[model samples]
Target: MLNEMRALTVSELTHQIKQQLEGTFFHCVVEGEISNIAFPASGHVYFSLKDSGASLRVVAWRTQAGKFRELLRQGEKVEIRGSITLYAPRGEYQLVANQVSPQGVGALYAAFEKLKNQLRLEGLFEPFHKKTIPAHPRKIGIITSQSAAALQDVLKTLRLHRPDIETVLYPSLVQGADAPASIVNALNIANTRAEVDVILLVRGGGSIEDLWAFNDEAVARAIFASTIPIISGIGHETDTTIADYVADLRAETPTMAAKLSAVSQDELRQALDLFEMRMTGVVREKVTKYRRYLHRLSLRLQAQQPAHFLKESRQTLGYLSEKLEHLMLKRLSCYQQQLTNYEARLNPRHLVGQQAMLLQQLSGLESRMADAVKRKQTQEEQRFEALVGRLNNLNPLAVLSRGYSAVKSGDQLISSVALVNQGDELTIVLSDGEVIARAETIIPHENSPHNKGI
Candidate 1:
């Protein structure tokens, strides 16, 4: 009976343990001081994360090890986010960390906390100092790195939600020592213009040091001093910064900040309803104010009529075009979101084909809309030119321009040479001037009536 039982080889036992460990500790975050940190010529990192009594082996592949290699000092505290796997050959369980962040990093953290507390004590975070955001802002100014994905995210959200709103970008450095000054300058410029109703200070999520620029004292003060309401969307939802507290509004992410700056379709519809009810009362109460406004508007309107007409017309078309395009893109993004959730389960080929087809459809639609706009503009120009042609045809000066003249004999138009006798007084009207002449001779044809002279 003992012979009937099978014995597990060393390889089999190791594989079974590896499966168990990987299944349970597939992903986790651990914090400890690094020790015996070794970076060999192969570029992989070998280290041990240990506290008082326990030590865990850690391995970082070349791709991720480079980012934190300089900070890999022995006994340095850090937080590692990775999965655990067993190296079957050595039968050792080690952490495979892809992200390593300094934990309560000695100087940077202390400095950050110090500044944050100082700002709070100064009442920079007070709610009373905050400016109210406009309900339906016509213009939104954005401050961030031009290359950041946060800018793209906010722009996409803005386009999707409010295609009619005008956007102005104030690109600046969102990292390093100079970032604070750059951000402050951008804020000052946006406020100086006093053109935009709101400003969004935003950037993507990053490590603490990478995001330290947003936590700067100068940036926080700039946000507090802004005349325009500022919405801070710096980093992920869990990340906290001093600028977020000093700003008028704090968004969980850059996308949410963009959402806050935009007026949704539902809000627009509700606003329209409320506007109608408020208009009558508002007009009655503000008659004098409106009269003065109208006087100023009349003067400006007279000067800007043609330009205003064209600008308004183009804005209407642009808004419509943007709305249509973004709505379609939003739907595609939804499909992409769904695909992302099932990307592992679905065939890659199928996903690629689906994306290609959608892109083709979108391109066709965009091309057609562009062509339509072009054709409409062309048709209007042609119609205007046709009207001008008809007007020219009815103009008497046009015939005169084409080498024609009129002869008047004694205040009566002379139609035939016979009517103009020799030495008759005649007034010849040319395009430029008039000539008064006494016909010296009259040449008449035999077939002409009364032997009319030519």
Candidate 2:
């Protein structure tokens, strides 16, 4: 039977198809690699899941995406469990994922865990095993794909930071199956040459599979054992590989690694200029201080010289000597005036004439005075001569010479008869002769009745 076709709106047709697909698909699990991941500020994740030739769009809202946010990354293999839904407004179909897990990890994760544990026991990730990055590298060797943007970025950054840095590039495969061996050989070559101060293993951002070479055990071990300090700058900011753990420094990008290994020339020049200015200021200050000190010392020296004082003292002595000489000359002139006045007061000629006249008058008076003095002298001379004649007549020697005999007893003369006694020795002197006589009887003076004198 021919039935009339019912008319339906475009919205109705789309709604009906969405409902039917939602009912038929239900919630299911799909495992594939992630591609074209896009995150917007709306807190929603948008990406595609793909196998060999097919891809399905996915949309995980913020509430459901929280669990898988850290685990989801570009090119990572994951299994997602979600409900199939069709957006009516956009007329597009997509999976609204509710949960996610790493693919093949049910069995592989156990083995990974077991190996990680075993390695932990062996101290493969010990901090003591980590090497130190050089502060100022003289030469930097780069291990990267020859055509990569990472190599160009690293070279540009090093030239900007330090133009004097020497850099060499060792080309290698950064992706695919052969990348790990290429990187390991590059590291070995860099170590053997000893020409580079530091080694940088770098590549641009890519999917996890593209960056897998850096996670290889051989590459990680080679990085750890490198003599030169190694810096890993692989993938994007969110990617972390096993090489990151072993490298001496892990930079987010190749440019950042170059900046970390070198210094800026402009900053160094500014510092040197400041230092030179400070040294000049210090030297100038010292010279000024010494100059002022020398000036003060010179003035002090001038004040202390003995020549000025000696000259002043000599001038003073000369003034005093002149004053003494003038005083002596004045006294001599006064003495000369006094001598002239005394000479005028005592005229020698006048005094001598007056003495001559007085001498004539005195001569006339001397005739009378001399006559009186002569008469007095004549009488005194006569008296003196008469006294002499009397003295001569009274002389005992003269009497003895006159033949008058003087009787004496020893040296004494007998003056009275009474002095004579009976039996006394007598000394008699007759003229020039002396005799000693002895008294025979007492004698008396004849003036009395006794006749002793007879």
Error of 2 at 384 (Å): 91
lDDT of each: 0.90, 0.84
**Which candidate leads in lDDT?**
1
Compared with the true structure, model 1 gives a TM-score of 0.43
Candidate 1 lDDT, tens digit per residue, 1-454? 9899899999999999999999999999899999998889999999999999899999999988876676678998998889999998788999999778798655676798899889989999888888898878989999999999999999999988888899999999999989989999999999999999999999998778888989888889888888899999999887788889999999999999999986786688788889977997788879978889999999988877988788888999999999999999999999999998797647788889889999999999999999999999999999999999999998878888899999999789998886777878899988888999999978777887777335
How well does each candidate superpose onto the true structure, as a TM-score?
Answer: 0.43, 0.48
Question: In model 1, which range of ten residues has the least summed lDDT?
Answer: 445-454
RMSD of each: 47.7, 31.3
Q: For model 2, give the 10-residue run with minimal summed lDDT.
A: 105-114
* Number of the predicted model whose TM-score against the real structure is largest: 2
What lDDT score is found at residue 52 in candidate 2?
100
